[model samples]
Structures are given as C-alpha cells and as structure tokens.
Target: MAGNSDPLTPRAKIAVTAGKAVAAASRAAGRGSGSVIGGRVALKLDPDLLARLAQNLDVVLVSATNGKTTTTRLIAEALRAAGPVVSNALGANMPAGITSALAGGSEARYGVIEVDEKYLAGVARDTDPKCIALLNLSRDQLDRAAETRMLAENWREGLAGSKAVVVANADDPLVVWAASSSPNVVWVAAGQMWKDDAWSCPSCGGVMQRPGDDWFCGECGFRRPQPSWALSGDHVLDPHGSAWPIRLQLPGRANKANAASSAAVAAVFGVPPQVALERMYQVQAVAGRYDVVQFMDRDLRLLLAKNPAGWLETFSLIDPAPAPVILSVNARGADGTDTSWLWDVDYTRLTGHPIFVVGDRKLDLAVRLEVANQHFQVCENVDQAVQLCPPGRIEVIANYTAFQDLRRRVGN
Candidate 1:
C-alpha cells in the first residue's frame, strides 16, 4: 500500500484512501483485477491527481506495440540501484493504471511506467518524464486501435514539445518516424524482426526497400538511422566501439533487444551501462511471461504472443525440433474481439511439431492451421491439452486473457 504523505493535498489524500479501499475490497471479492477500477475511482475524484503526483519525480515512460511490459520491468530493475522505484507491473497500461501507480508509490523518487501506445502522447505530456523509450510499432488490436501510421503521427505530435530525451529503436522505421521530432533523442539498433507492417515509408508513402537487414525508401530519402547503441548477436556495442555482453535469464533475441533499450534509458539517468545490464539479468520472469509452471503431470513454460510480430519472435525462440506445444487464445475484451490476426501468422513453420490448440478461439486457429496443412489437435482445456503431450516439458503460449487465466491458475 502507498503511504499518504505531505505531497498530496487534502482532496488528493481522500481520493487515494478511497481508491485503496476499493482496491482492497475488489481484491477481497476476487471479481477481477482491482487496479483498473480503483484507478478509475481515483481519477473521478481528482482528475489532476496523476499530474500532481508525478511532479519532482524522475520518470521514465515506455511504450510499444509489444514487449512494453518486459521492457518496463527491466528499466525498473535497473533504476532500483538509485533508490525506490514505483512502477505498474500488473500490465495495466492506460491512464487509470498509470495514475494508480503514481498515487501508490507517493514516497518513491523514481517512476518507471508502461504506457499504452494509443495513450503515449497524453500520458507523456501529463507526466513530463525525464526519459521515454519507444521499442517498435505494429498492427495490434485493430478493433480498437488506429492504424500504425496514425499512432506514429500521434506520437510525433505528442512528443514535439517534450524536453525528455527519447530512446528509440533505430531498426523500426515507424519508431524512427515517431521519435524523430524530439530534439533530445538516442537511437538504438535493437533489431526489428517483423517488417510486414513497415513495408511502406510513412513519410513519402513510397515502397520501402529492405536489403539484408537495412531498410531504405526508394521514393523518399528515408533510411535506417545510425544508432548510438547497437545490439550485435549477444553483445551490445556502444558508440565508442566498446561491446558489453548482455546475459539475461530470459531467452530469445527479442529480450536481448529489450536489455539494450533499457540500458540506453538507464544511461540518460546516470546509471552505468555495466550496472544496468547486471540488474536486467536478474529478471527471470515478468507477469507470468517466460515462467515455467508445474501442472498435474507436466511442466509448462508460458509465453505470451498477441500479434503476428509477437508470434514471429516467439516462434523463433522455440527449439527447432518438434515437441509438445499448447497454444491458447481468447477473444475476450482484453484479447480483442477480432481474431483475424491469426491468419497473418506463418503457421507452416510448425509443420512437423506436435501442436495442441486450446482456447475459445481454438476452432479459428485449427481452421487456419488446417489450411496450412499443419498437424494439430484441439483440446477442451489447458490441462487436457497438456495431458496429450508425452511427458516432461511442454511449452504453453497464450494471448492476453488466456495468459492471465493460466497465470492465475498456476499461481505465478
């Protein structure tokens, strides 16, 4: 619980108490996550509560289409060396969640927050953060979100007047376009594995050319920006030609990229690169991501993939050999009502592997996999799906709602 302090006014103090009470009641009831509802009540009582609490704090805001939660966790871990750090680790990324975090961690001197992509502009403006990290951009939650380019434009417009230093991914063209307007910017070549969304140049509407990992526009002069921090394989190269090894317990190149991005943001706050990287490696799991859970008869490693880009990166991280895998999906409010993005994933890559499709949308995934001629079986439940596997270790990957369900069931 956050302590009530002198920084909060009389009205703000009342709102905080009310919000915390609601959170406690909701948690006691077990209806749903209390973070969102508690924050809503707080904001309703005091609309300017977030801005007031954020004053005089060293804040870092992280936004992206994917990996924002993990990246924010890494940044928060690195900032722990300085002092107490307050962050929203529950995956509540909107204004309500951001406000709740600020209100709860009133005594902390530093804040590391994960802001949703659509709300990045408004939150950054209100918080007046010291640094902002832009990971990448892709099509996600098409039912609710605007087009990728539109979001990028909004980000460009939102950060135009911000004095905060922007740490952006140079490999992602959309991220480059969004953060280009900021006067204080640091570019990092954090490796963009998914390029389907960035086929066209946002500036000129021209076809972008990708010639062996480098992107350039034929019509416009837009090209991949030179990076101040570059991640080559397992090593992060600094501008002065020095390389630092990033050894993280989390697997995959995507996590390596995340570590590099965190190191860049930490540098802006006077955290040494070695210290930042060391702290980043301490994170073994985040919000059930990359966690191995012991079920009735199997050990399942959880992975969350919400979009085509996320699936691509997650697929690459899996072992090449065929094994038992459980893919759970749901189209609930949090998972997006439209499951059309399933078609965009290259299911053919798992041709020889044994796959178990489980979730409300298992039929949809089965149809897509059938069209791809991939072998798979649909199970009634997660436990049932895992029961089909031979034994030992099984990999479980899920979207938003299904991941949460599994996380709660497994007690992660």
Candidate 2:
C-alpha cells in the first residue's frame, strides 16, 4: 500500500496496505505483476484512494489511441529533470494500474500517467491533472473501444471548463477537436501518417477537406489551428519559431512526432524544449518496444504494432531486409477480439523480405499475407520462427498480448 506511513487517512492507508499486500502475494504466486489487482482491491476498499493520493501531486495525464504509452514514458523521463518521478512503466493504463502507480510514487511531486483512450474521460475527471497531452487518436481496438468521434467527444467532455494545459497534436483533426474545448491548449504539428480515420469531421459530421497538411470542414467551418509548436523537415520548431534539431535513440518519424508532443507538454511544466529533448533522447525504448535480445544465438529486435495505424508506424522502424521480419498477433482480451484490423495494414510492403508469421492468430495473419500475395511461413512460436533464419539479427513485430508473451519468452 502507498503512503502506509501516515500521510493518508486511516481508511486510505489501510486500503493501500491491503492492496499492496495482495499485489505482492499475487506476484509471489506467479499470477501476474500485482499492479492492477492491488490497485483494484485498494480502490474497492477506499473509493477515494486515487483522489486522496493525488491531491497534492502535480499530475500529468497522457491519452491517445497510439503513442500514449511512449509519450507518457518520455514525459516522465523529461519531468525527472525536476526531480524523481513515478509512472506506470509496466504499460498499465487503466484506473487500477494508474492508482497503483500513483500510490507507489506517493512521495514524487510529479505524476505522469498513460491513460487508456476509452477511460480518459473518467481518469481525467478523477486525477485533476496539471497538464494533459493529447496525442493523435485513430481507429484502434474498435471492437472494444468507442468509435473515433465518440471517443473524441468523451475527451472534449472531460476537458470542458478544465484549466489543465493541453498539449495537442494539430495534424490529427480528432485530437484538434478534442483539445479545442480545453481552456488552455498548446497545439503542436505532430505528424499523423495514417489519416484514414479522420476523413469525417467530429464537429459537424461533414466530409473533412485536406489540402496537403491543412484540414477543414465545409459545414462546421472547423479547421486545424495554428500550431505553437511544429515539426520541420528534421527539427522541432518551438513557439518562438526557434528550430531545435532533435535526434533520438528511438527509431522512426513517429517517435520524432512523439518527441515534439512530449517537449510541448514538458514546456508547460517549466522544462524547455532543448532540455526536454535531451532527457527524452536518453530513452532508448519503452517497455519492450525496439528491444533487441539474443535468441538462439541470433539477435531478435521487438516491435509492437497494435492496429493498422500502429502497424504502419512499426513498418517505418523495421531494419532493412536480409534482416528477416516476424509478424505476431493475438486476439486476447487485451487485444480486441476482431482480427479485421490486419486487413487494413499494408503487409505488401514486405514483398521482398523473408517474413514469418507466428501468434495465436498466425493463421489469420497467414491468410491476410496470402491475400496480399506475400510469402510467409506460419511458425508455432519464436523458437521455430528463428530456427528458419541464419544466425544474425531478426525483427519481431507483434500486437498487444503477443508482445507480452514474446517479452516473457525472450526474458525482456
């Protein structure tokens, strides 16, 4: 339990202790990391556990369909320049996971929380964040999550009349619409490569017209706002129009966009872009994404792509061919049951590479790849997948639950 040493009230303290104990027991018993269960039990014991723990902390809530976890990790790392910061580094974005993270970081002055998109409204209403970073929202987990427009509406409703400084992505119309309702918003031209989900305007249900980077609706007259921060060819332009060149250890343009968003949020908390970028550059990977591990004497690098938008971004990060690519997917509860999203991803881009498909849904991936006319072998697991390749480096791109399974198998 967090604050077990007298800061919280008797009820909260007891609840915290009980939750902590349960989590510890669960971990010891090999059930899972006790993060979520402990937090859930604690919340049940004391409904105000989160509010009480977060009362004095300067919380920053980050939410989006994609990049929220990575953005949250980057924000926490940048905020650490001020002091020690605590976050749910384990990828737990729900209330229970969030509460556990906050409780664990009870002494830290700043709390950076990654929130699940559907739960953003409820989490924001409870956390009372000092700053909110809204990354782009796209079609992800559609089988379980609300549709894009409704999710944006929920975000707008949550931010209504709130004073939190919102750092939003101007390139994403969904994000622009959601943060538009916030009183304090700092718009950044964070690039959105996948624009399929933003064709319809959330404001007036009209077709959104996109002329190059500019987007507007004919009916509502809503449009992309002038950005206070933006991404140039290879640099991030600050509010002063001063261009700051950013080089990150993380790969792909998506991370550069993420860095721009993180820097914008950090600026609201008194950390300058130059400083924030420096701290962010130190982060090589989030959770296990982009982590390279030795498997069967071959180096296997991991990448997580949960949806079509995410898969598109992951494709940008793949190592050049001769380096074999393995695609893994699962439709577990963590991953939405519908595997239709696989159809939306352009797997034909890997037409020349040695591709191996493996997962609980490997047959689905195999079927998708076959329809695209891409050749791949369906493997039972990573061990079998890597056995087909010569000893060197391999790339493994997986969806939600599949990524976790591989992480444990690879000892990440």
Candidate 3:
C-alpha cells in the first residue's frame, strides 16, 4: 500500500495491511507498539506513516555520537515553549522512530527527530529534513560504528548536498571538519567551562594539546574558539539543580554542552537568544541521561553510557569521591552486541571503584575493574546490587538496555 514495487504480491499487501492494522489498533488502544525498525518491533511510529500527517511540516533531524537524544529533547522542549511541536521524544532516532513520531502527529508546525548517526543516510534521504543538527561526534560503539571518522564520513554523505541549514559543534574538531564548508553552517561549542580534550586533532593528525580550558593543535595551531553562543558556568542550573524555584534540573558538563547545542539550534531558527536561553534554563533531564529518581529510601541517578566517550564523561562527573558507585554491564543483545568499549573507560578514576557490578556481564566488568586495581562486589542480579547500594551519593553507570533493566529492578 505504501507504493509497492509488486502490487500483485499478497505478501507485500499483507505487510502494508499489518502496518496499517498496527497503526490503527495502536491509535484505538492509545498505545505506541507499531513502529518498526531493522525488522524489529518499534516503540515509535514509522516515517512513511508520518508523511501522511501534515503537509509541508518542517522536520529537524539531530544526529551525533553522543548528546543527541538529550539535546533533541531539550530543543523540542524549548520549541514547545514557543509553539506546538512534534518530536520523537522517546530516544528512538532511527527511521522507524522518526516514522513513528511523524505518523503519530496530526498537527505539528515542526518535527524534531533525533537520528542515529548510522541511520542518518537513509532517514535524511527519505525524510528530506529542512534542518539537520550534528551534535558532537565522539568514539561510540566501535563494533557497530567502526570509528568516529567513519561516522563523520557517513553523515557527510547523508546530508547529500541538501540546502538544509546545518548546526555543528565547533568545540569538537571532528564536527568542525565535517561541516567546514557548508554554506549555512552555524558553529557552536561548550565555551570556556569544559576542561577535557581527547581524540584526533582537527588541524593535523597529531594529538590536540590542551593548554588550559581550551584545546589547541600544536602541530597545526588550530584551536577551539569561543562559540557565537556559549554558557558561562561549569554547571547549568534552572534553580541550581532543584525542581523547585524554577524547575531546575540537569547535571554534568556534557549536559551543559547539550543545552548549549540546543540553544544554538534555537538561534539558527530565529528564536531570540535571550528567549532561547530562558527556555533552556527551564530544561529538565531527559530520561537515562543523568535523570535522577527517588527510590524508597535513597536517590538513584540513571546515566546512560553506551560508548567510551560517554563512559569517560560519566566517570569525570562522579567527583571520584562520591558516596559509592554501582555499575551495571550487560552485553546482552539489547544493550549491544559488543562490550569492548568497556576497556577504554577510565575506571581507574572511581575513588575506591564501584561498590557493585551487576548484569549478565558482571564477571566481565568485574575482571576489567580488577585489572584497573579497583574493587567491586559482583552481584548475580541487578536487584541484589541495588539493595547493596546504600543511599548517600550513589552513581550508576548503565549501558543502553541495562539502565532500564536496573531501573526496573531498583524500582526507580
């Protein structure tokens, strides 16, 4: 039914019929179970179905190695403060999720879809977004993504010579180089607040030398400059991390970068900078990206770390002296097919190391932790681990699916 190549094939018709039936039934049941991606069950609507919603709805696609999901949600929230908006707010960034968001909407002036870097080519080619935002690219899921350079090249091809305005992270050399010559590119960075730099040099192949808060390439003299719009604080506070006063939330330097990136997009969309900043200050944490929750007796924070960069950032934020750390490592099919990135994480920074390690891959992580000369309690189950993580200032580092499994167990 979706303009089939073989109109006479009953199988094709049945597939289309199934999609329609699923969509219809989901609508009737007030559910979100019909979205499809990679032939797997999708939690978001399909893009083809979304095309039928509104005519000429502006679509914004955000893709990156990290921070895309949170940044997209923040951008969507900010835009919603201004007007009605539809986005794949559920962290599903592939084609199916994009499709689901589009399909579920009836009247949306704008569509903001977070996209997976690997799926960007297909999604952008099919969706033809009016604007595409490339957040910072970092090393992530090496087995699936190959390397950062590969992802950068993929996105470069994905844009496909489009006229869409591109928003890039100028702080990230990879992003800066990827979108260097784009006509309408807007460069943004985390400004002077961030204090760490790793990865390849944008100027030359040599390592980037960090002289201070900024990074400079000694080989080629290319340095990270102050962006057109930059945050001035080490932390972004709505009410200074409190849900009261002004709906304050969000933590970590990476999240501040996410907020800054969202603000940059708002600027490109013609929203007044001050207005955007005000809206940004109103942002709360998106799920799994440092989202804090209250358990029966203690506070549980869920921080998703799917790759080396994210894991490193998580470690950097923990103060190395936080109460205790609980790490859940599940290399199950859902979290990922590869857990090699665990080796790259700076586990040595944890003060006395994580107190508990749980998941199907608990032993693997335990062994890794042991090699780092860090001590850990290997628990057979996530619930058992959570029970062992007593209150105070506990931190959790969970991979994609493990985060949900742990949350479900911990009752957070």
Q: How many pairs collide in each candidate, listed in order?
A: 0, 1, 7
As for candidate 1, its clashing pairs are: none
Model 1 lDDT tens row, 123-237: 9878889999999999988898899999999999999968999999999999999999999999999998898999999888999999987898999899998899999889888
TM-score of each: 0.97, 0.97, 0.80
Cα RMSD, each candidate: 2.2, 2.2, 6.2
How many residue pairs in model 2 have overlapping backbones?
Answer: 1
**What is the TM-score (0 to 1) of candidate 3?**
0.80
lDDT of 3 by residue, 1-412 (tens): 1331222234433434455566667657755344543212232223243344323466678888777887888788767656678887878676655655665554566788898888877776666667778877766555566577667666666664777788777667767666754566766655422223344574467778765556778888767754555544543222122111112277777777777667667655666444655676666667645667776466777778877777867776773564677888777664566777678776887856457888778888888888888877888875576677766656778888788776676655
lDDT score, residue 281, model 3?
A: 66
TM accuracy, model 2: 0.97
Give the runs in model 2 whose Cα sits over 4 Å from its true position: 1-7
What residue pairs are clashing in model 2?
1-16
lDDT of 2 by residue, 1-412 (tens): 1333445889999989999999999999998889999999999999988888877778899888888889999999999998778898877999999998888886687889999988887888887889999988888776898888899999998888887999899999999999988888999999889999999998988999999989999988999999999988778999999999888999889988989988898888899888999998889888989889997899999999999999998888887776799999999988999999888999987878899989999999999999999979999898999999888989899999999999999899
